[model samples]
Target: MATLRVGRSVARWRVWSTSASVVVTEPDTLAVAREVVDAELSAVDRACSRFRADAELALAERAGRPVTVSPLLAELVGAALAAAERSGGDVDPTLGNDLARLGYDRDIAEVRPDGPAVPPVRRVTSWQDVSLAGRTLTVPPGVRLDLGATAKALTADRCAELVNERLGTGVLVELGGDIATAGPGPAGGWLIHVRDRPADPPATVRVTAGTAMATSSTASRSWRRGGRLLHHVLDPRTGMPSSRVWRSVSVCADRCVIANTHSTAALVRGAGAVTPLARAGVAARLVDNQGQVHVLGGWPS
Candidate 1:
């Protein structure tokens, strides 16, 4: 883990193949804040990791019948299902098998950059097929659950809220660019440098306390297989990687999960995303495949 002191103390580490950063307004609370983030991250990884064979999700998938799960997993799954509904199936959690067939069965870092041709697998089951009653979850016979889309953002939201509640200090938790904050912010506000790719122009925006931001990118978590470039954001309809109409989409909302849901959906929606995103009434910035930037719903220019 790396730590930086700039009025506040920030700790950075790697988890679940992505970077995690935690910042606290009160420097003295930094250690305790880091502890809270670490504990929560570990818990989330255990509950929702798609790559871990011993994770709760794996066990539930292997059972083939309804199985009781932890409240955390239930909440995670619930959020994912809600996202799928909100996006009209553009953001789906039941594409796990489709993703695997396209060469994303393991951690992104472990995925082979070049592999044999694998045809796109049609979705046999949609998010509607998965059932969650109380804590019991049921995955259909051939369906697999993938929580990658929403679980990380939910963890960020959870960690920030938990840190602020327990430590009584303003905290910002960023997991792979899905950011959430709570408590009182620093002077002015929390300044976030928003950019999807390293070469893209950056914009610094201030977010007040208790708000969240999430960025979904086709540029990241991508690989080449059989001469075709593939990314993680899949269209549930075709069970294939979405065409790169937009390289990335960033959105701001009151909650990280909501913001992430919209951003990921925008990628799947492609050029047609503007009208729907505009209707949703959230501030968003979209970077197209040609690097043209489009701002909507009062997103700063």
Candidate 2:
């Protein structure tokens, strides 16, 4: 289903570069919101992109020493590390090389068209290998850092905060499948539709103000490598695509970062995710490989 936008006088901008959509409830503040949203994502990409040669993460890869990074990068690195710890290493920040070795060196959309073969590679660098002290970060010499799992979510959270607090209006920002809202929502709250695949039936739900939602899916961003199916979501332990027991997982939390962390970790954890998600008190929905659905932590059926 196409992304549905609600509310009156909202300016909607879709950024394909980041697969993001900026929706501001107050039409008058849309310009400011879009500017802030774009700036935030651009800054994040410049600071954290693994594909850019001049990105901070890229510079940290070759510095072979403590590299001074911007405060934003430092904060995001800390968030990624914390997410890794919270997810029990299920969502790692140091799998850049592991993913690259698996032939996911480029964006998943680009990698999917060729259907190249990639062999299973074991995770070599753990989050522990990347050391951060305030704004200084030290990565293992020759190792690459990929914050893809966490940076986007952090961007949404930051964008929402900036837009809401600065503009004094309610705003919703979605970076791909992760959605976050700030300030007071519309009368009935913000309505969002969730589905594992584009063709799948959607389940629409309204989020209260300040709520965030995220979905991680294996159904998308998949390719065939070495005659084997490969996906963007990888188990850091084996550096292989998850076994695909669960096709997708969606979670709602107070913050987009936490929600995204939970959803991505659920995809990596497969069938075992239910217990941990319940324990975390997250409202979530999981769809299995066989198309079975499971709801946990009071997720709406």
Strongest candidate by lDDT: 1
lDDT of 2 by residue, 223-271 (tens): 6766787778888888787778888888989998999899999888886
Where does candidate 1 clash, by residue pair?
A: none
| lDDT tens per residue, model 1, 65-129 | 99999999999999999999999989999988888989999999999998887786555689999
For candidate 1, the lDDT comes to 0.88
* CA lDDT, every model vs. true structure: 0.88, 0.81
**Count of clashes, each model:** 0, 4
**Runs in model 1 with CA error above 4 Å?**
1-8
Q: How many Å off is the CA of 275 in candidate 1?
A: 0.8
For model 2, the stretches where C-alpha displacement exceeds 4 angstroms are 1-3, 11-18
